[model samples]
Target: MQTVELTVRRTVGRSLVFQTKVLEVDANRDDPTIVVACPEGLDPLEHHFDASIAWTSALGRMEYAVTTRPERRGRGRVWLLTLTGPLTGVQKREYFRADVSIPVVVSWTDGPPAVSASTNGTEPQTHRLAGVVLDLSEGGVLASVSGVPPPVGTQVQSVLRIDDDEIVHAATVVRHVSLAGGTGVALAFADPSLHGDRLRQVAFEAERKRRRGD
Candidate 1:
């Protein structure tokens, strides 16, 4: 265990895991223990009795087993959680994200193939849905859609546009959608290429430059 302070986030959404100040830590001990002020909202001990703590140390980001069965300290909201063992191997992020907003078209087959009377051609009954890409990364795009979001585990073809460049990729809608966030959904890219990566990066940089009055 290292003595350096760590910033931890939930692995899924990269949301802050805690908003409390560290009260005590015994990193030198064989089995370390950490005491932190409980957050104002949810009680960790209620559900997260045993969970993983993702933190970045001097070595890198890593996660370790943590027990939330707190030992109350007097009347204050501070609670102690024991780290059962040493920190596990460092965790490496799979992708870098670029925050931006861009128009995206998601196309998916609704049902069986349909035949066009004018063209006399048979094709999959595809439906096109519009969304705004809230964040772009090599792994996925988090988008805020207009209408009802597709169900989880559904795979769809997406066309992302950054200026004149349009890149198409297959993506899956994640289950953790936020309706309050304008029907937002997380789409994981099945196969991302360098072309799409460059487009997203360039678009993000351009947006940054614009905000700088450049």
Candidate 2:
């Protein structure tokens, strides 16, 4: 049986919108698989590929990393890649064929501009960026933000740690929408589980309250 190896690719731009890059994966002719390597500094989201994806011979994209290039140290460093598609698993074998994506600070000091949402009654903090999330794999997140839409194939670090554990990560603004009472925005995340215990706790409490009508 032939297998397909999936990897993530990404891009970093001025803004953290649809700035994802697409990589050229050598599609397997005999095996119907694509094997790509994980670039430096990036990681893959782990829980987004649990369904049957229609087999398409098209290449996909994702985010990789943000680093300070040695040569360009003065200007700082940021690198991202676009992969063929999200990694998939071979039946019940080794989970999924994924790459490495770096996780951002729920709210770092000099990190990406993050929108702080306190779980407890704590003071509001910051992360990196904020916007709608797109795709999430394992390593990091992909997001879409405000302002003019970004070009296709551009991956930006666009997530805000609203809470301590349950920070919203890897998201994208699907499109700009208008609502009767509010501004409509769309987003995506890497994986609900990767969000940590706080997010899960919130979900659990919500469910419990709903059941009790509290």
Candidate 3:
């Protein structure tokens, strides 16, 4: 009886996110379905509405997209979610890393690049560098930048364009390596702020597209 997080969103409303216990997994059927104990007082989930489920596993957080329906069993209601796609394995950090190439702009406050100016209570000068995000995850991104790369531990801001959406994140340079044309650096998000869900969705979609060779 493992606990899993469930999220359901109607086409025109906010998402419903809650924790539920896994009751059963029926994988033998044409469309595998997972049965989970419904939370008390929850409205019946919209029939065949899309849902996302996540559970922590030994490898990491695992996520799945499903079509949900309410079912009755011995007077207790349960959620029957049919698998709509392959399970996505998020890493130990609870974020799925996607291999992608997208344009990015990394900026840092001028001065000691390692120290954020907000800590000193002074108006900070800013500098920007153009880069291409080689890979992205909910927690961070690996990017290739021409010219000099920022040192490890430097705090910076990044703007990433994915499709028609633009995401901005406060990040710290975590790792770097020399490359033939430029330097590759990894920036871990310091705080995802209001864009956490957006980041996860983007990473998931990118991973799915990669798997499908799209």
Clashes of 3: 0
lDDT (CA) per prediction: 0.62, 0.31, 0.76
Error of 2 at 15 (Å): 44
Candidate 2 regions exceeding 4 Å error are 1-168, 175-177
TM-score versus the correct structure, for each prediction: 0.48, 0.26, 0.56
**Candidate 3, residues 1-214: lDDT per residue as tens digits?**
7766677776865566665778888889988889988754467654746888986554668899988888888647888988888978677755556677889999987653355566765555777889998877667889999767778999998999878877898899999977678899899998743576666666655655554456
Q: Judging by lDDT against the true structure, name the best candidate.
A: 3
lDDT of 1 by residue, 53-145 (tens): 543333444666666545567546555567755777675644434568789988777665687779776676667789998877656788888
List clashing residue pairs in candidate 3: none
Candidate 1 — which residues are off by over 4 angstroms?
1-93, 113-124, 179-181, 194-196, 203-214
Instruction: Give each model's clash number.
Output: 0, 54, 0
Per-residue alpha-carbon lDDT of candidate 2 for residues 1-214, written as tens digits (9 for 90 to 100): 1122222222422211111122223344532322222323333322212112212121322222222111112223322222334444223211211111223322223334445566333443333433443323322333343443333333333444433433545543344455443333333334433553333333333333343345
Q: Give the Cα error of residue 113 in candidate 3, in Å.
A: 11
Question: Cα RMSD for candidate 2?
Answer: 19.6
